[model samples]
Target chain A: MNVLVYGAGQLAQMMYLAGAPLNLNVLAVDVANKTVVHPVEKTVLPQSLEQAINDADVLTVEFEHVPEELLLVAEESGKLSPNLQSILVGADRVREKHLLESLNIANCEHEIITDIAQLDGICERLGEKIIFKSSRDGYDGYGQWRSSTAADLPELKNIFTKLDLHKVPIVAEKMCPFTRELSLLGARNESGEIVVYPLAQNTHHEGQLHTSIAPAPLLSEALQAQALDIFTRLAEKLEYVGVLAVELFEHDGVLLVNELAPRVHNSGHWSMHGADTCQFENHLRAVCALPLGSTEHGPAAAMINIIGCNTFSKNFLSISGVHFHWYGKTVREKRKMGHINVTANSYADLADKFGNLSEYLPMEFFPKLLADADRIK
Target chain B: MNVLVYGAGQLAQMMYLAGAPLNLNVLAVDVANKTVVHPVEKTVLPQSLEQAINDADVLTVEFEHVPEELLLVAEESGKLSPNLQSILVGADRVREKHLLESLNIANCEHEIITDIAQLDGICERLGEKIIFKSSRDGYDGYGQWRSSTAADLPELKNIFTKLDLHKVPIVAEKMCPFTRELSLLGARNESGEIVVYPLAQNTHHEGQLHTSIAPAPLLSEALQAQALDIFTRLAEKLEYVGVLAVELFEHDGVLLVNELAPRVHNSGHWSMHGADTCQFENHLRAVCALPLGSTEHGPAAAMINIIGCNTFSKNFLSISGVHFHWYGKTVREKRKMGHINVTANSYADLADKFGNLSEYLPMEFFPKLLADADRIK
Candidate 1:
């Protein structure tokens, strides 16, 4: 079977690798050029995008933010998985909020500001701490703002007023004070069979995912059950047919939906070694209508992103269960170069591996390395 | 780093997949045409063999049967691991026998026959039960024959008389029989760091490998250590810098050397799911001079070759720890199309999985599966 993914990035490259052993020929469309390409090499393939789509048994996206025009064309093919609305929901915060509301899913209390004037008394309505985010991605001057007090509202408004709110609205969310971020990666096949990998606790640095510890250490069964229930409701409601990532915030033993990614997620990358079936394989399986593999994980696993700095050598791989994955990308400031997946006998062992991992990585880049390692125990 | 492998087949394809994650660009030399090609697609690359050799940081072979002419050129590049001798030893039974003899290795008593006339009373010298094998591959009428008594010698001679024994020669050996076949896969890196996966018990049907149970259930420590010792000796003698496989015949709690492969071997395929590092990745790591990975295996594992059978579906993948790998070849009688790697909690669990696996595999093709499954425990 042929699977055509809409973005030629690391995710697609991973999907290609995962699909190969299963005899699934995965091709990618470089959304930037709208041309079919080999995901790994990022080299243009000898086929038009239309030809690729027509040849593909299933069409999917590596990223939810695929160009609306391209997505429309793909959706019209009647082969796109997760469907258009689900993808739009992932791409647009407003749409995502509506999805949560429609499903009665637990999420951060928020309000959508379609117009600039709606910002008036927004802090009072929401909370003292409000996080204002651009409802949709890929727009000029789109960014986020945080409001702590009423005094900072003017400066936040000054930054927000420059944007065309009518074109790309603002989602004002009352910042929920949570313990930590966790993401559940699950897949819904065409047959409506659902399988979810263990939830992974994510640690972010500068708004980018730095690391993920799977099975989210110390997580209560209730929290896990809650996440699963929410995922089932969302997937069934959307009739989702592919891997869906639900970012959640756990507060006082309650789980709240923070965001959604309608594709294989970075947090779940540990599954490549940790779980019996990886997210990429499950995603391809779901989209291709193959049997969903078991989401069972063996040992405690963690994924650490190799961001920006390329100073590390292959020496750290000397550690057992340390699998290095380089995306083969050129080094740039804050660019996601690659990642490392580590499997350990226990959480304490993982913590030790994490501490040992710090010795190899540039300390300036991985600021949380040793601290997080020490914290894991 | 680029690793050029000779012989564009499933082995090379697997090597490509394993190398990709470590940022190793693996390409294959289709020895028949002497052209560089993508291992997975078998598509001719834009580069010539010379360019591939020049560009590769290391050169290796997926199959020892790579044409000597190509091996010579790869050797000239001063990058081929295991070197020319090791690969030649694997390609020719005579050279392998010589290697074992020189190393004082234990093997079946054998005689080299350069002339068909030398076969006189061969059954008396070796035994009534003797096996005659062509010393080299890739020649007309190169095959194995057995003789049970003096009565069968005349017919065996009749068959051997047609060949030019002066060039290829024949190896007549006492057919040692006792217990099952097992193979040890190990790697020696540039720094002389060696690691060996646990011995894998092999089952053969009609001279073709049918199944491999890893950690070779209930193996004695002494036997395992003996295999590891012999492997260490052979690898050190050759100063081997890649994965080396030693096929053994276990008799009376002793392991006698049967054959050697200079590259990855089929028996080690179970490592794809069972061990901390797969043979392909370890082969790449060895050749790339990277640190060797742990040989730790997680559970009882088995690898079943999908020989000439394309009757199975993806449904069997629903079995947890069942990993399917298709070579994407058109099935032909007695040809290897792909393989399945299964990991189980125990030998009993493995047996149950094997029985379950037979339901999906064509019974006629996998005739030994159920029987072997029953015998595992």
Candidate 2:
């Protein structure tokens, strides 16, 4: 079967590798140029984007923010998935908040603001401290504003007005002191059979994901169940097919929705070596209407992100049990370079081995010296 | 590091896949035409074989029968592994039998018959029941003769004389009735570190391996230990580097060496999904002077060979936990098409799943009807 994925990026490249043995023909379209190319074939140009979509048995997106018009074309032919409405929810905070509220899901109390005057009302309703976020194109802590006190709110509101907040409505949320961040990656087939991978504990630095540990050691059974419950409710509500990642913040003992990704996600990259089926392969299987793979963990896993620089001179290749995935991307400042998955017999052992990662990893990139030590330990 | 392998068959393809993530650049050299190519890059050109060899950090073979001149070049450069002597022992029965005898290892009783007169002397010494084998280029039950009666012996001797057996030399053996077949896949590094995976119970049809079960289910502890002993001794004797596979036969409870593969063997294919580090990866690691990967099995795994003519149908996509690997070979008659690995919680469960393989797999291509049933129970 042929599959056309919108966006030619690392995720699409990995999907191509996983699909090869199954005899699944895959062409990735870089919407900007409307050029279709194979990830590994690297040089083989296929039909035009429109022609490729016409030949595909299924069409999907690597990222949610694909242009609406292109998505409409795919949807018109009944091929696009998670569908346009679902993609919009993930792209726009206003729609995302509405969906969560409609489902009665717990999220930080918030209000949509379109103008400086609306921001003042939102601050009054939320609290003295509020986080302002653009409803669209905001990611990695970008397109945001913060008001710590009532006196500061008016100035922040003025700044929002100058930026034309009304043109792109913002979601103002009450800032909460959450203890930890967790994420649930679950998949559902068209048949509605759903499977949830274990919750993952995520850590980030400089607004980019730093690492994630699977089965999120020390997570209570109640917390895991609650995360899965939230995923099941959202997946069923959207009639979702393929993998969905729901980011959560644990405030006190309650989990609040932070964000939702309607496609395979970064937090689940550990599954490539740790789980019975990787999220990419499972997503492909689910989208192809095949039985979902077993999501059981084979070993305790820890994933550390490789960001921007590649100068860790300790020789990553020297370590046993380390699987490095280089995305073959041209490195730029703060760009995601690749990741390393370390699997061990036990969570404690994995932590212990990773503690010595500095011996092989270049430490200059990870500025949080103590944080690295604490994480692996 | 770059490695130039001397064959472009399945073994070379698997080695290429295993070496890729390690950033090891592996180029396959077509021995027939002396052309060089990369499996993933899939580019072939008329470069001098010597140039490809000069480009590699190390030189190796997927199979042992590379032309002696190529082996000599690699040997002169101190890059060839298992060396020409060790590889020649595996390729020629005369040298293999002589080496075993010199080491005081018990093997099938045989005589080196050069003519019809020598055959009669062989029968007089080892009795009427015997097998005749060519000293070189024999595999998959090819290039050998079998005689059960005296009348057949005269014609076999005549055939040997016609082929000028004296110049090539041939080994005649007293055929032994063996209860079962097994193999040991082990690796030895340049630093003298050795790691052996569990012995595998193998079943063959028409001399081609059909399936393998790890830990050789139901075997006594003594036999397993003896198998390891044989492997250790053989590895040390040749100072072998990289993975070596030793095929064995069990007569009653005693194990006897059948054949040896100096590279990753078909019997170890299960390691891809079953073991922590597959044989192919470990072989690459050893050859590159890198740390070895774990060989721990996730669960009892049963690997079924998908030979030619047994094509995958549309419904084949429905089998969960079944990992399929298809080699893009165009030839259809009796080829090693691909393989399907089915991992289960237990041996019985795996056997039960293997039984249902026919529903998704075409069965006529397999010579033995009970192959699916007897794989792993």
Query: Which candidate gets the maximum lDDT versus the true structure?
Result: 1
True contacts kept of each: 0.74, 0.35
Model 2 C-alpha lDDT per residue in residues B229-332, reported as the tens digit of each score = 88888888888888999898889899888888888888999888787788988888888887677677755776777777644574554555568776666757
- How far does residue A301 in candidate 2 sit from its true spot (Å)? 1.8
Model 2: residue A147 alpha-carbon error in angstroms: 3.2
What's the residue-level lDDT of A24 in candidate 1? 90
| CA displacement after TM-score superposition, residue B229 of candidate 1 (Å) | 0.4
Q: Interface Cα RMSD for candidate 2?
A: 2.9
Q: Which ten residues in a row have the lowest lDDT in candidate 2 chain A?
A: A367-376
Model 2, residue B245: what's the lDDT?
92
Give the distance in Å from residue A175's predicted Cα in candidate 1 to where it truly belongs. 1.1
- Candidate 2: residue B320 lDDT (0-100): 54
Deviating ranges (above 4 Å) for candidate 2:
A30-34, A37-55, A67-82, A138-142, A312-320, A330-333, A366-377, B37-54, B68-86, B102-106, B138-142, B219-221, B312-320, B365-377
Give the distance in Å from residue A157's predicted Cα in candidate 1 to where it truly belongs: 2.2
Q: Among these predicted structures, which one has the highest DockQ? A: 1
Pairs with backbone N, CA or C atoms under 3 Å apart (clashes), candidate 1: none
